[model samples]
Structure formats: C-alpha cells, structure tokens
Target: MALKINKTAVKEAKAGDKPQELRFEDGLILRVQPSGVRTYYVEVARGKRVRIGRVGTVTPAMAAEAAKRLSVKVMGEGVEAVMPVRAITLEKFIADVYEPFVEHEHRRGKRTAEDLRRSFADLLSTKLDRITSRELDAWVRGRREDGVKAATIAREANQLQGALRFAVERKHLKVSPFDTWKAPNVPQGNVERYLTTQEKAAIRKALSDRDRQQARERASANKWRRERRYPELPMVADHVMPMVLVLLNTGMRYGEVVKLEWQAVNLTTRTITVVGEKAKAGRGRIIQLNDEALKVLTTWRALTNRTTGLVFQCDGEPIKSIKTAWKTIKKMSGVENVRIHDLRHDFASSIVQRGGSVYVVQKLLGHGNVSQTMRYAHLADEQAAKAVALLDGHKRGGR
Candidate 1:
C-alpha cells in the first residue's frame, strides 16, 4: 500500500521479517529492511530507480527534495545525468547527450557533431576517465605522421576538447582529460593560397561556360520532353556559380552565404547584413557589394524570380553544399591546388595589393582583430613603399 509520505509516517513505519516497501505519491519510496533500516529511492522514470540516502543520514523532507531534484535533472539532461561520471563513455556522451543539446542550441551543431565523430573515431569508445595525456600525445603524433597540417590537427583537437569541457560543465564528468593535454601550436595569419590574376580570369570563364552548358542541356532535355508530351523542366539558373561569385567578391564565409535570407540583402543599397546568430563571430556586420558581386546577385535574383526567403536555395530549401559543381569548375578552369576557401584569401590579397588598408580589409572580411588581417600586410609592399616615398617629399629621381 502507498501513503502520503511524511516525517511521522516515515518514523513510525515498522519493518517485517522481509523487506517492507513504503511508496509515496511523488515516486519516492522508503524501503525498510528486516533490521529496521530505511533507505530512500526515487523512480525517475518507469522502472528506473535512483538511490538517495539512508533515513538516519537524510530526513524525509530532505530525501523528498533530493528526489524531486533528481527527477528534474533526469528530465532535462537524460538518464546519464544521474549516472556516475566515470560510467559514461566519450562516444555515449556525445551521441546520447552532447550532440542533441548542441544540435538544438547551435546553427552549425550538426557539422560540429560530424567533425567530432570523424576526428576522434578511435577514441570515441573510450571512457571519459580513461582518456589520458599519453593517449592524446600518441594521437597527435599519428596525425603528424599522416601528413596533417599542425593547424588542421590543432583545430580538430580543440573541438574535441571543447566537447570534453562541455561534459565537465554539465556534470557528466568530474574533469576533462584534455585539461592536461597541450594542443598543437597553430601559426597565426598563415594564408596558404591566393588566386593569381590569370587563375581568377580562368575560374570566371569556367563558371560562365558551365552556366552556358547547363542552359544548353536544359534546352535539349526540354525539347525531348516536349516532343514526348511530358512536363518541361524549369530553365532557372543554378545557385552554385552565383554563390561562389558572391563568396569571392564579398569575402563572406560559405555558411554565412548559405544561411543568408533575402530580407538581409538590400539590393538597392548594394549591401548584405550577416545576422549575429549566423555570423561566425556571434556579432553581425554589413558587407558592401562590389560591382561584380552586385551584378551577379542581380542576375541570379532575376533568374530565380524570388524577392523573399533564402537568397540561395535549392528547391525552396537552403543549400547544403556545392561540392559537385565546385569540382567541375576546378577541373574546367585547369587551376591546380586551389580550394574554395582560397577565394576569400584572393579577395583580401587583391584589396591589399590595390592599396586597401588593413583596417578596411579586416572590416570587409569580418575578422575579429587586425592581427588576423596582417597576413595581407606583406602584399601591401608597394603601398608601403609609396607611403615611405612620401616622407622624402616630391620624388624627383631619388633627390
């Protein structure tokens, strides 16, 4: 029989020869053994019981409050929330708890989750307490052997360490194993590749040629469909070419461009507003569109016939990736050892080479600090020379 458990009821409860059970309204139970010892247990969910404490250790009131807290914590953080920290494995924590929480809280949570899975595949099954500095050192050494760059290795390690820190914050672990591990040093302002003038022209030509080819293919397919009395395909231009052009011209990150809504873009003002939530730095900023970018956007908008919703979408949905088209563009352009990210470096390099200030470049690229933009300072060699030349006052064949 169950009762409304209280101090008097709990105290007056007698034990039998066998274990006697006293159930309460809030899933709180007092189990009395034959020796007259009482212990508290809380049922967080169906058939899931969590031990609280003994009666002499914790009063009925204290036990009930603890039970309520346990139930609430379990409801919010899942069953692992109540489990001992050492019992949870790194993989289980990521899959069962961390991933779901981040997926709800962050825009790039899915990607972050995928990165963790791929980067730490070998360590996923290891328990949190089992992860040691020696293991991490070996992993870093292995990555170096595999020809991974120090920066790439550092980024991946930091992301994994972040997940471990989150576990500590959530009380899922006593401490993060990464707390003692030193991350690989990443060089500052190491700009790897910037497109040359000829390369840029070749890429532009490739994009234009791809668009024309797409149009021809669509036309031929539509003609066949018309002859067969089938529905004709829409002749709208694709988002890849225009999106790449926008990235190159605006120096906007791919994520920012993909999530960009029409409401954020002011065609009349020739500007784009990167929302704070979607921006990498968690702060919003405006990007002034260049003549080439403006024209590309205008043509794309006209072709798509959209004035609302996402600026670049596929079948009325936000685009996931442009990898296939990007590969084709690279092959067609005959450019070697260039990545999509290099487009942004090229944009910054061009600005500095054309006498644009570091401050202006920082603002355009939405960098958090001037130091990040200093990679292009060397590219401003000619501009720097001109500035120094002004110190001489009236350059007449070097005085």
Candidate 2:
C-alpha cells in the first residue's frame, strides 16, 4: 500500500514469507526481505528500478532526497543522463588510442603495443575505471602461479602501467589504475648465462662446419644456375654466422645489429657506430671491432658487395629472425640451454674475466647505468683476486 514514508515507518517495517514493498510517493520503495532486511530502492521510471542503499545505512530522508533528484534528472535529461560515467574497455582504449599514439612516438612502439596486449589479455575486456590496484595484484598472482619469471612479469607490468599512464595523459582516463601498484622484486644478483670454454670452442667449430657446408651448397646452386644461364648468387648467401660473430664480439643488441648500416662502419678505425635511434640507451656509441669481428665484417661486406643499406638483409629487406639457424647451431654444437641473447652476456663475461672494469663493460654494452653492468661484477671479483695473488708472488720474491 502507498503511504507517507518516514524514519519511524521504515524502522518498524516487518517482513513475512515473501518480500514486502512499502511504497511511497515519488516512486520510493522500502523492500522488507523475508529475513527482515530492509533496502531502499527507487523506480525512477515505470519499469526500471535502482537500489539506493539498505534501510540502516540510507535513512528515509536520504532515500527520499535521492529518489527526488533521480526523478527530476530522468524527467529533464532522460535515463542515460542519470547513469554512471562510462569508461572504454582496456582493449578498445589500447587498440584505438594508446597504440596509435605509441606508434607515432616510439621506434619499437609496435612491439611494445603487441607485448602489452598479450600480457594483459585477461584484463582487456574490463573497463579502465574498474581496474583497481587489487585487480592488478590478482593478475600478478595469476602470472606467478603460471610460472612466469618475476623479471618478465615486472617488465610486462611496467609496460601495461605505461600504457595506462599514456591514456591518462591523453585524457582517455582520469587516472592510471597502476599508479599505486608496486612491482614485485626481481632478484638483482640473478646471474646471466656465460658460455664455458668448451661450449665456445664447440660453437666456433659448429659455425666453421656450417660455413663449409653452405659454401658447397652455394657452389652446387651456382652450377645449376650457370647451366640454366641464371645469375650466380653471392658466396655469403646468409647472415647467420657473421651476425653471430659480431654479437659475440661487439655485445651489440640484436636490434642494433640488424639495423646497422654500412655508413656507420669505419674499416680504417676498426669501429662501428650504433645509431642512437636503434640503440637501447637512446645515445649513439662507437664499438671497436676486434680482429675476428673486423675480418668477419670485411669478408661479409666484400661477399655481399654493398656499401650502403642494412648490414643484415635478405632480398634487400631486413632479416626478421634467425631462430631456426641459431637453434640448429646450438644443437650441432651440443650447447644446451643457451639463448641467442646469451652471446651478449658471454661478450661481457669475457671482458670481466680478462680484468676489464665494469665501467668499461657498461660503456661497451651501451648500458644506461652501471648497475646493469654489475651483474658481471662477480666475474670481476675473480679477476681482482687473481690480480691480488700476483702481489703475493711479488712479496715471496722479495723475501
């Protein structure tokens, strides 16, 4: 029955077998449940109902006030106007807005965009505003449960946070959900893989065997081409071995090496310039080439017969990947559990073991900070001990 609803009427409301609705003017309702729990609801329109709060929490006066305001809003501005502020879904925002901005702004933007999309796949469908810090914690816990490395998880999380921050900057979001999120601690002393002497020798032998095999294959193909009167291909048909040598010697990142152009190479100075745009450090640096590296590049340059364009290209296009070749090389060499990137680590380790300072290693590796080079500090410690032992030998001679 419709009646004048007040605090006393709401407080004294009783429940029976079914829910009892105490209706009032202006479409305000106090619903009393079977267990005697009362909640305030408002029928802003004829069929639509909106829950305000419970009776104890939302008093009759407050419910009445809210109902009146909602009614007035619906009458003047329509139902959509009274609805909560809508936010775009995370996936939609990233694909439509953030990614496009990143593509225009950053060199590796496409890769970064793809990584974020893949990493935050679970949260893609969720609305941006609904993604709280608690939600991120659950996501991180899920990743941990899936056995994803802490460092990898931290990197992906940071990328997602960066995308959200970009959204806020572009006015697509009010604030980033990850603004207060703390990344899980990554073990700083986690040592990188350094190839052993036997492994190194095995890899070199494998490369030599592979190069000989390739030479024979090239000769056979050239003979077939000559018979068909087609143009003979170059001796250096692929970039796999030469690129590996450069990576091992120069400690150049895969991207930097792939993007390297002939213009940056100085045969006289035996140095190669890593352009800032292609470099991870965002600043250009010159890398001095050792005898093996200089010879490899010199032979590669002569064989390819190119004075300009990418150092590693296939059919005049940049080589996308050498995964298959690297895998084959590893298998042939019996080198287990070594990643292609580990060659860079091996390069740094060689210097450290030879008593080169971490500061020098940092500069050679183009690390923005010395802390990155500190992962090889243990190797330096061994070198330091060896140096100190030489002083002991000198003291013995003096005695």
TM-score per candidate, chains pooled: 0.56, 0.55
Clashes of each: 0, 0
lDDT per residue, candidate 1, 1-399, as tens digits? 546678898888899999998888667889999999999998877877888899989988888888778878987899766765545887898898889988999998988887787667678788877778987887776554323467778888888888988888877777777767777554333344888889989999999999899999999999999999999998887787899899889988776888899899898999999988888657789999989999998998898888899999878877765666877999999996666677778889889989889899898888898999998898798778988888678566476
RMSD of each: 14.1, 13.4
lDDT of each: 0.82, 0.83
Give the distance in Å from residue 84's predicted Cα in candidate 2 to where it truly belongs.
32
Per-residue accuracy of model 2 over 270-344 as CA lDDT, tens digit each: 999998977864778889999999999999999888989988898887775676687788889999777667788
| Model 2: lowest-lDDT 10 consecutive positions | 182-191
